[model samples]
Target: MTEKKNAAAIRGPSDHTIRDQIVAAAMEYFSHYGFEKTTVSDLARSIGFSKAYIYKFFGSKQEIGEVICASCLADITERLNAALEKSPSATEKIRQLFQTLAVAGCELFFRERRLYDIAAASSREHWPAAVQYEAALRERVLAILLEGRTAGEFERKTPLDETAMAVYLVLRPLADPLQLQISLDTAGEDANQLAALVLRSLTP
Candidate 1:
């Protein structure tokens, strides 16, 4: 069978319901067990489904982890956007972005350490979800830079793309799952200090 056809067959006719059920069960299982230690078979048994049945929805344990990881990242993005919306200026928005992301990362690390493990694995493995999340974050930073420049609040001599990339890199330690775990103790202070430095650089 073609790859598309194989995927469809594996998903079967009740694709959405079955897929959601599998993902929900996997989230609960991974929360207690962590991602690396649990296998698809273990999740299948926990949910009262056969291994073959679980396979109908997900190809492997990592696939389930990806779904949960994507969900976690999406939640962080939502909170970041909400915080940004409340800011009156581009400078405040940029600061809000860093603070919100740092706070979110710390919350995940301390409260949901197992889910944080899944995120770390996703980053370490270069999963598509992690890659997309990074891309989305970069775009947000670029957009903020453009807004600041257009408003004459930021210097326009430097290339916006380069500035965006630099800003993203500075924020990566607080945003990237693997790095965030290592930086938790100092992430909040680092985020505030970095935001101040970035804002200074941008001043026209």
Candidate 2:
């Protein structure tokens, strides 16, 4: 009943604009004050909106965080796709994938530390945005493996799904927002070495 009401509240004629404004303001506020420190009331005041009005658009602070997290993850995905497109082969695509993710993770960690915290929280909590990001990333790895096999560049004996899962797991530390922070110092080197190891194993 309450969930239904909230869903209905989020779908009015002005909902899109209002919701985007609230989220945009929340992003800036949270980026400066930190997501953990900012409350709905604080965001409301900063954005010149009543707390109740803000709630009409977002069920909770976490919901707002979800939008911001999704946007950030989308940007990372865009960079990864762009890097892969520039690669000459599936082997190069796999290498670029790891390198792009590592570099993007490090950039976010240092340049947008507070926004990164929201992403870390989303990852830790298994928010829908984070879950979707992981699924898409796995699909990308699976696609790359399939491409390599078809090109006669990789072994076809191993099950593609299993191989993709293994590759995703190998890259998880660098790809995971929380884990990336812990391994920041060595993440780039780790990504390069792991990519090489994975490429060697994938060879026919």
Writing each residue's lDDT as its tens digit, candidate 1 over 1-204 gives 011122323444477887888888888888899889999889889989999988767777777777788888888988998999899989999899889999999998898889999999989998878888888899999999999999888999999999999999988988998888888898899899989999998899
Segments in model 1 whose C-alpha atoms lie over 4 Å from true places: 1-12
What is the lDDT, from 0 to 100, of the residue 14 in candidate 2? 65
lDDT of 2: 0.87
lDDT of 1 at 127: 81
Q: lDDT, candidate 2, residue 63?
A: 82
TM-score, cand. 1 vs. native: 0.92
Misplaced by over 4 Å in model 2 are: 1-13
